[model samples]
Target: MAARRKPALICCGAALAAAVVLAAVFTALYFTVLRPRPPRVTATVVGTRVSAFALIPSPALNLTFDVAVAAYNPNRAAFEYGEVVTVVRYHGDAVGEAVVPRGEVGARASAEVRAVVEVDAVEVFSSPYFPLEGIAGALPFETATTVAGKAVVLGVLKIRASSVVTCGVTVYPLRKETTSPQCTSTVHVG
Candidate 1:
């Protein structure tokens, strides 16, 4: 009877030890692996709106535009706003880059800064002959020659900021606006 009791107690202890080890391992994994990731960067636009464009061309291609974007710092720290370059991409090709003036708006208390997009004399490369990547993209308004086309300026929103946060693996979609060079953006966001 004593021997049987001893074996039973040993078996129970072994099982309990394994259970304890498993629990510790699982707890470590959860804390390290299952934690929610932080947002490293965010972007938006402020003072965005639409407007009609009519320039030096006598018979202008009737084109309207909507422009807006906001830049955000998705970390818990404050970042210095560097050169805010806004590039316009059409059909996976770069059409133009707008230099956003620094000191637009930045705050450490808030992890967001309002960026203003000031575009000038941008042309629409909507015609096949005037591909967004060709000279026709940035056409000369003084020239009477016209090439009808459809182009969208995809705003590549990027900032020269730094942070230690690790954002989740998600697609930060490219924001854009469709407008003639004569038009500008006056969009806003919080």
Candidate 2:
């Protein structure tokens, strides 16, 4: 009876050891290969159209801008954004703003968001440099866009991410034209 019990004990021990080894191997694979990764998103300033711009009589501007932004997601997940806020600034002061509706970008895909920003009665006199630049036909302006959202991976994992893009552009009020925008962006994920 003792000999039979000894053999059974060895068999049970061997089975336990094999189970532990398999678990360890699986954990290593999950961390190194199968684990979910954070998604990469990028934003760019596509184009801008100026409807009205002025700097005469009362140092006020009444302009409407058609702003387009592109959002790209380079991951195997879908990025669903809550809201997008865009603000137009001159000399660090906000002159116009627009809120875009929530949307989603598919995995390894891109989406474009278009917003119409209307500047009504913007006080151009707030900045002393405005007059100098306005007279030279090259008024500098900035547009900042903030997007906050979450990435859903395999319909199970949710990762939070956000991006902010700021662009600089020069506008010629007399000619009703705008220079190509130069943009930079920051992205965060958790």
Candidate 3:
């Protein structure tokens, strides 16, 4: 009976030690990888110009816009992002959409993703409030853009982050030029 009790005590001790080791690993991972703050995101308009409106049958506007979005990882671990999708809205109406190429951002590094979307007059007309002057004349317009993707840390812990940017820009069709939009973004982590 004494010998049996000794073996049982050893087994219990071994199990307790294993549990402690597992707990320590989980805590370390939480502090070092899982709990890191989300990355910072920013966007800017580039090479966007208004095209001449086609008014032969009806009023139609065509424009090409290029928006460059950058995600700056502030954590020590690299962030691997899946495919990113960006949607551009005018007056709360979706006018254009694009998909960003997927890639990994190294630790404390930033990755620039470019999305080019073409907007037409039909999309603009869909909005209740159409700024004809802004489309025809040299007035500025605002676009609310959202960028969403899944980010992983060390290729293990994964989380979803989205960034929203509102931009004020002007496109000159006659001159075939445009002013870079002013954009501000907020990041949400889940």
RMSD of each: 15.2, 3.4, 4.2
Residues 18-62, candidate 3: write the lDDT tens digits. 999999998998887666667787877766756666545666678
Q: Candidate 3 clashing pairs?
A: none
- Global lDDT scores for all candidate models: 0.34, 0.74, 0.73
Q: Per-residue lDDT of 43-124 in model 2, one digit per residue for the tens?
A: 4445555555565565555566666767777656777887788888888888889999999988878888887777544445
Worst 10 residues of 3 by lDDT: 133-142
Error of 1 at 65 (Å): 6.6
Query: Which candidate ranks first by lDDT, i.e. highest?
Result: 2
**TM-score of each predicted structure versus truth:** 0.31, 0.75, 0.67
> Stretches of candidate 1 above 4 Å error?
1-39, 45-50, 53-77, 93-96, 102-108, 116-122, 126-190
For this target, which candidate reaches the highest TM-score against the unseen true structure?
2
Query: Candidate 1: deviation at residue 149, Å?
Result: 38
- Write down the RMSD of candidate 1 (Cα, Å): 15.2
TM-score, cand. 3 vs. native: 0.67
| Candidate 1 global CA lDDT score | 0.34
| Worst 10-residue lDDT window, candidate 1 | 142-151
Error of 1 at 182 (Å): 24
